[model samples]
Target: MPEARAPVHVDGEVVASKRIGGYRHLTLTAPGVPERFRAGNFVAVSVAGHVTRRTLWVHRVRASSAFGPTLDVVVEARGSGTAWLTAQPVGAKVAITGPLGRAFALPKEAVSCLLVGEGYAAAPLFPLAERLRERGCAVSLVVSAPDEARLLSALEARRSARSVTVLTADGSVGQRGTVGDHVDDLVRRSEADVVYAAGPSHVLRAAAGAAERVGAWSQVAVETSMPCGTGLCHGCPLPVVGEDGVDRVVRACTEGPVVRGDRVRWDDL
Candidate 1:
């Protein structure tokens, strides 16, 4: 892990915002957030009239864009908080606190990697793929959604992964199926040593199990209701079996968001 940096609270200006497929993508001029960001780190954005801040995974970070340093996040406007974020104008200001939570651990060896992503939460994996490729790791990506518009860009995914597999539930685009139906086969084909996944709970659960069956290490980025991005709220509890053989609950905002797939109490969640 890169040297950790303290989270900073800043009033950031929305540099760009657009609709990408079925998601809302935004770029914010967050001065210190991008400088300290790691692949799995996320930002907590203050909602206009809500006391609760929305936690969004930092999709991509730009050290310098036309608007200066910026970071991107993809949001699904399924709730009031997210809806407000997507509605922000270019010049609108939003309060952001980041680069928070534990990051996905990278491997020391140049081993083959398999990345599984579903929906907008797949946002973080794009950067992870770049980092893995930089280390000369062979990366295979599996992107899935219910339909074409819900899937992340396969064109962009191809640039990072050695291979890209697209799956859709309704067959509106790629393969007609869900991750559970095809992941085991993909893992066997890639012979991946490590599997990294991000997305909905069901997707993560399925990916984790497939990786385990293939004897591959698995790390999953989980999405939960994080009322506050900081650990102070103790609102986002994740049940896990600690290394000490103890079953405990940890704050997703602090201890995780990224955790060993096997250790999670998936049945409980």
Candidate 2:
């Protein structure tokens, strides 16, 4: 686990926030963060105090040949933590931490990549798709959302990919079931060599199962709320393979927010 450093005090004035049905797509510009941050990293922002640092993956690190760096984080305005995150005014001050966490196992040498995400899970994966494309890997994003409007963001992600397929629970987008339902067909048709997923435990489990059935390697980013972002807190221990198939605990804050799907002991959850 990394040391718990003091958060950089930043003032992120909300540039734009759109309500796409049940979720809010927020684009904030915080000037204090350094420009060297990669796409799949995250920034932890303080809401009330140090105990509850709101962790948000970098949805898109918006920088251009002309424009300055800006970060986009999707905030679901459904809970106390999220609701408070969305309610901040335009000029509100925010305390944010480093572009933490390791990058996903995306190798430029791979022929093609398949990315699967749900809700805020799409954040880090979105940037990964763009990076893979830049590295010449054929990227395909298959996203699952709850409704039609929520499908738009997934559609945008497809533009960066070689192709995109969307699945919605209500039959409003690409398919009428969970994204896992279409994994077999998508992999067969796209001939993707690697798979990456980030979302709830069930989603990762489902994805890992599907990938395993096809003999494809799978990786997932797990989420946990910890009082200390560093491993010393021992508050975010996740199950990992220890010896001869026994499960050992690893701190999510330090070892990973990202773990290979097959290596993680999901049953311990």
Candidate 3:
């Protein structure tokens, strides 16, 4: 967990909700709280009891000096949990548990960092890019979308990036292909020392393949459905390589939702 942590009782009142291409970005205002929320860390939200509070990562953390923490969560609206969140009005007070989980381990020897994401997986990466850039790492973002509007919006937001690339299955974005196509090209041409991926399982798998092929250090953030944010629930467990070269299940809540790419058997997931 993050060390500079203090929980102030707060509610996320929906400030703005809009659909951009294939995904939805919702902004919430949680007053009087220090906005130390980072990219890899997530917030647990409570809706009706029928649906358990799901942990959603911070896509962007913006807080006005006048107000408190303003959080933006992006969801694809694929399930009941996200659907309920999307249906909420602008002033709804949603119970939120926050700023949990470990951070991305950036390499000191890295030349350039490459981030690859797709769909709703783009959330945590927005803050991550800024953090990496602040650390003096050359940061590049490659997000995939099905339409041009979403692709362009993401690209425009990171206009200050050393390089911004977009890929789409449809020919509507920068490249008419999956992010893997561009990732392959970037790794080869840019000679990036570290690669990070967050998105669909298949997308991560493809990135892992590319990273392994090039001998670059790769890490992936795995999105798991969890019953409890704490590890006791054992709901979000993934098979990880043990010290004995065997497989052992580890809880995503505690051990990690982020793990070394090579340690994960991408094909099994």
Best by TM-score: 1
Native-vs-model 2 lDDT? 0.72
State which candidate, 1 or 2, has the greater TM-score. 1
* lDDT of each residue in 1-269, candidate 2, tens digit only: 13223335465656667677566767767664536456555677777643667778778877742225777787776567778888876556666675666557667485778888887767788888877887889888878877776653765775778888878889986779886677778777777677888777777877777778788888777876755554566888889885478778888765677777788888885
The global Cα lDDT (0 to 1) of model 1 is 0.91
| Candidate 3 local Cα displacement, residue 184, angstroms | 2.0
Candidate 3 local distance difference test against the native: 0.72
Clashing pairs in 3: none
- TM-score, every prediction: 0.98, 0.87, 0.88
Candidate 3: list runs displaced more than 4 Å.
Answer: 1-10, 31-34, 149-152
Residues 1-269, candidate 3: write the lDDT tens digits.
23314444467677788887766777877654326565676777786755567777678777663345688887667688778877888777887766655557766653688888776766777777787887888887777876675552465447535777778889875788887666788777657778888887777877777888899888788887866665667888777786578988887766666777778866556
Note the Cα lDDT for every prediction shown.
0.91, 0.72, 0.72
> Distance from true position, residue 101, model 2, in Å?
1.7
Candidate 1 has a TM-score of 0.98
lDDT tens per residue, model 1, 1-269? 23236899999999899998999889999878898899998999999889899999888899888988899899989989999999999999999999999898999999999999998889899999999999999999999999888898777898879999999999998899999999999999999999999999999999899989978999999999889988998999999999998999999888889999999999887
Worst 10 residues of 1 by lDDT: 1-10
Cα TM-score of candidate 2: 0.87
